[model samples]
Target: MSLSKLKLTTCLWFDGNAEEAANFYTSVFPNSKVLHIQRYLKNGQELHRQEPGSVMVVEFELDGHRFVGLNGGPNFKFNEAISFQIDCANQEEVDYYWAKLGEGGDPAKQQCSWVADRFGVSWQVVPTAMKDMLASEDKAAAGRAMEAMMHMKKLDIAELEKAFRG
Candidate 1:
């Protein structure tokens, strides 16, 4: 969606690395770019304590979804409760995203297709077919697929399909 057509934008709080995070995100996704970067000014220096010229907010879009990264300071941290999900069309897409997003991430948090990036942003990389596999009318098939998925870190589409068919 175009920036003008965006009804709501997600603002992500960062710790003095809003621009860097925005660059990283834009590089990872196709059709994405850093739309704008705003730096801090003297107006709120006393309250924010940020360098006058330091990055304040970065507005960017990832495959049409607009996001804002704000250098809101060290008061907040990203948690696993919230994450972005990438639906892959096949195994190749899944592998690509898993490796890219999972780079430099905490290994402990890499499980069941969920990965925490270097900047502590969490993402889920799953094949598009996964939705159908896990929601099939056949309860037994769906259960098998679910069980197989639980043991995986990056999702395996072939394995999930095999289990579902069994």
Candidate 2:
């Protein structure tokens, strides 16, 4: 949705890295771009503790999703509780995102198609077919798919389909 039409947007807090993070995110996905940037002014420097002209906020969009990245200092940090889910249509799509987002990320956090990026932002590179496979009317098939997915870090759609058929 366009900025004016949108009612809500995700705001990410960063410790003076909002601009860099916004650029990184826009580079990762197609149809993404940085919309605007707001810098700290001399008047607000006392409260923000930032140099005048330093980046304060960056507005960006990633594949149609709008986000505001704020240089809100280190008081807040990102955790696994909140994550962006990317619906991939195929293994190739999943692999692309997995490699891109997982670069310099915590390896231990890579589980169930979930990865915490270098910026400590969590993302789930999931296959589009996963929901349908796990929601099938056939309980046996659904259970098999679910079991297979549990052990996967980067979901393998072919393997999930095989488990569903079994």
Clash statistics: count for each candidate: 0, 0
- What is the alpha-carbon lDDT of model 1 when measured against the actual structure? 0.93
Please report, in order, the local distance difference test score of every candidate based on alpha carbons. 0.93, 0.93
Q: Return the lDDT, model 1, position 49.
A: 97
What candidate 1 gets wrong by more than 4 Å, as runs, is: 1-6
Each prediction's RMSD to truth: 2.9, 2.8
**What lDDT score goes with residue 141 in model 2?**
98
Write candidate 2's Cα lDDT for 1-166 as tens digits. 6567546799999999999999999999999999999999999677889988999999999988899999999999999999999999899999999999999989988999999998899999999899888778999999999999999998999999999999
Q: Residue by residue across 1-166, what tens digits does model 1's lDDT show?
A: 6567438899999999889889999999999999999999999789999989899999999999999999999999998999999999999999989898888888899999999999899999989899998779999999999999999999988999999999
What are the models' TM-scores?
0.95, 0.93
